[model samples]
Target: MIEKINLNNILFLDIETVPEEENFLSLDDDMKQLWEQKTQYQRCDEFTPEDFYDRAGIWAEFGKIVCISVGYFVNKGDIRNFRVTSFFGEEKKILKDFSNLLENHFNQAQHVLCGHNAKEFDIPFIARRMIINQIAIPNKLNLFGKKPWEIPHLDTLELWKFGDYKHFTSLKLLTKILGIPSPKGDIDGSQVAHVYYVEKDIDRIVIYCEKDVIAVAQIFLRLRREELLIEDEIIHV
Candidate 1:
């Protein structure tokens, strides 16, 4: 079934996120308490809420998307080019711009959004952030009342899982095992908050996010037993 879907119909993407504030103290008392409560089970006795604040980006309620990099395949004659672009800056602006892209260009019923673990993270995070920012959710990301097969979203992680719900594979690991180029550079997901808040290098984060998007597209191709994308085929727009 994966082979039946047209590569041109998919919008591949990845996002970089950071905590709403630079530090735990930056959050108001109410939010600080909420963060503590929310992470209690995961942090347990190993780390305080303040220490765990660095990972706040993993949750939409505690973090804001710093960048969303998207790519799509465009076939011009025999040449295949994957055009990549990003939306960064204010959280609201990022969400609004992405919403516009979805509503305007990729709004067709046959269009789908593809990412690594997108259904669990990228898709929902965007929806929640849009609601918080008071932007209307685009139909592509809006999952309300849609049957499982009717939703237009593809997840490389989910595809790799097959039927093992207990299994989890990181994109870096997946790429390595599948012979796709590693996406990691000077920073990784763990350091995104530091880069955004302390180093203030959004460009670096954008590059990292774009690499993941490319990797996701490559992974999907590999799963479908098709050729992987060459670096020369990637265009940063």
Candidate 2:
């Protein structure tokens, strides 16, 4: 049944994001209140352009994405053929180009978007940036408002939940639990912004993103196999 879902009809993606620059923050009082309450990070004491810039700098210097990697896996008989591509450039340009590529390559109505923690971070981040850029948001990404189980979205983190909501798990930790080789070397997510800012090396960022994509693919394979084994055992028993 899983195989019948057409693996080619899925797009696996990941994104990196940074905070808005000080000049970028022209938030009204209401907007500032909402943002301070809703944002994942801490809020500033005052709402000045300088404070906003410092906030953005904090993200640019640490919290934001430096690269986004996308992977497509299509089942070819016994083999799962995968193609991994990375978009690394100025954040605005990369987001624009990447959005265009997705629109051109896949049919929004047909393909299921897949990612690890994408629903929470990647999708929203991309969508917000697209709005800021005045780019059309893809229909698939527009499903963010839908309930988790209602949407066609497949977050590996959510899938790992099975039936119970017990604990929150990171992708790296999940890889270890599933015996999947850790693709992240000594580099972790926290260091990504620094690497991109200080080294100004797009290649390193690309490599880091590519490794994450590979890690995601490996995790998907392991989960699929585990599910198959469980199904087969149930059938026999």
Candidate 3:
């Protein structure tokens, strides 16, 4: 299905996010109440909202993006390289920069965005964060009334799903089953909030996020029945 899409025209991305506040107690009264309600069904009676706060990053309303790593394929004569770059810091700043990149460089009709589970997670998370930060949604991300086919987002997870919609697959599992090197050797998504909030290691998260981007690209190639990219071909920016 994706054989017709040019690899150079695709922008591969992944993001790392953390709770809006460093801790649950830092939330205002109303927000704290809201968070409790938000996680009610997911948390058991044994767990308090404060204990569950570590997972706040999963929800856009209670979380903020800390890093967004983007990678793209480039060619220079006989050389082919995959370059990855990250925009990170305060949530609003990263959102603004990412939105600008989308609006300026990747807004063309022929461009497609690919990431694992991006359609359900990353893409919408960025759009919602943009709105909350008062940043204008870029043309590519402004999905208000567009038809399903009009959306240019490509999700590796969805592509892997084929027609069955009841199951969920993690990127790590897919890589393992497909023989793609794991991107999450150091840490996984569940630890991101802790790493950012406790360790203050945004760089680590950025590296981890970039690894996911590379893995996503490899997964795409696997879908296309192409060979996987070798380690020497990746370039970080």
Candidate 4:
């Protein structure tokens, strides 16, 4: 199946998000209540809503996208280029820009959206965030009427599973086993909120997001038993 799909037609991507507010104390009464209720299932008895606030970025309702980095393959005769681009800033602006990119570039029958566990995380998160930002869903994201098989999403994690629903794999772990260089070095998903809130470093986050995007594509290539692209082959757009 991997060999049959055109790598050039897929948009490989990843996202970075943070809590809507830097601190729980910054949330209004209504938001506070909503967040507390939302985390009830996972929140431990000892931790208050404020204690769990740092994880808000994982939930679309309590979080906002800080960065969205995407890459796509372009075949040019003897050379192959994978161009990566990023959208970062205020959530509304990021969402709007990403939506426009999809609508203009990848909104076609031949284009498939691919990422590591994107179907469960990135895709739904982007769709929900776009809705919250009051932006119209792009053709690629508007999955309301599409049949199960009609959806064009291709998840590297899902592909790795090979129909084993009980198995789950992280991008980092998969890349390590596949002999691909680790996209994550010192920082990780858990530190994103702290980096954005405390360090105020969106650029760092964007770099990390782009690495994940590249890692996702590399993982897909690995699944097809193809050689991963070297750094020079990756172009930043």
Best by lDDT: 1
TM-score of 2: 0.73
lDDT of 4: 0.91
Q: Which wins on TM-score, candidate 1 or candidate 4?
A: 1
Highest TM-score model number = 1
Q: Per-residue lDDT of 1-237 in model 2, one digit per residue for the tens?
A: 344556677777776544442233455566555555544345345454334433452322223445778877655676545777877776667777777777788756567777888777777777776776677886667775777656666778877877466757898898889987676865666555456555666677677667676667667767677321121111100
What is each predicted model's overall lDDT from 0 to 1? 0.93, 0.63, 0.91, 0.91
RMSD of each: 0.9, 7.7, 1.2, 1.0
> Candidate 2: worst 10 consecutive residues by lDDT?
228-237
Query: What count of clashes does model 3 give?
Result: 0
Residue range 19-85, candidate 1, lDDT tens digits: 9989999999999999999999999999999999999998999999999999999977888999999
List runs of model 2 lying over 4 Å from the truth: 1-4, 20-65, 144-150, 226-237
lDDT, candidate 2, equals 0.63
Model 4, 132: alpha-carbon shift in Å?
0.8
Q: Model 4 over residues 1-237: C-alpha lDDT tens digits? A: 779898889999899988989999999999999999988889869789999999999999998899999999998787988999999988899888988888888888989999998999999999999888889998888889899999989999898998999999999999999999999956899999999889988889999999999999899888898889999999998
Least lDDT summed over 10 consecutive residues: which range in candidate 1? Answer: 73-82
Cα displacement (Å) at residue 45, model 1: 1.4
Model 4, residue pairs in steric clash: none
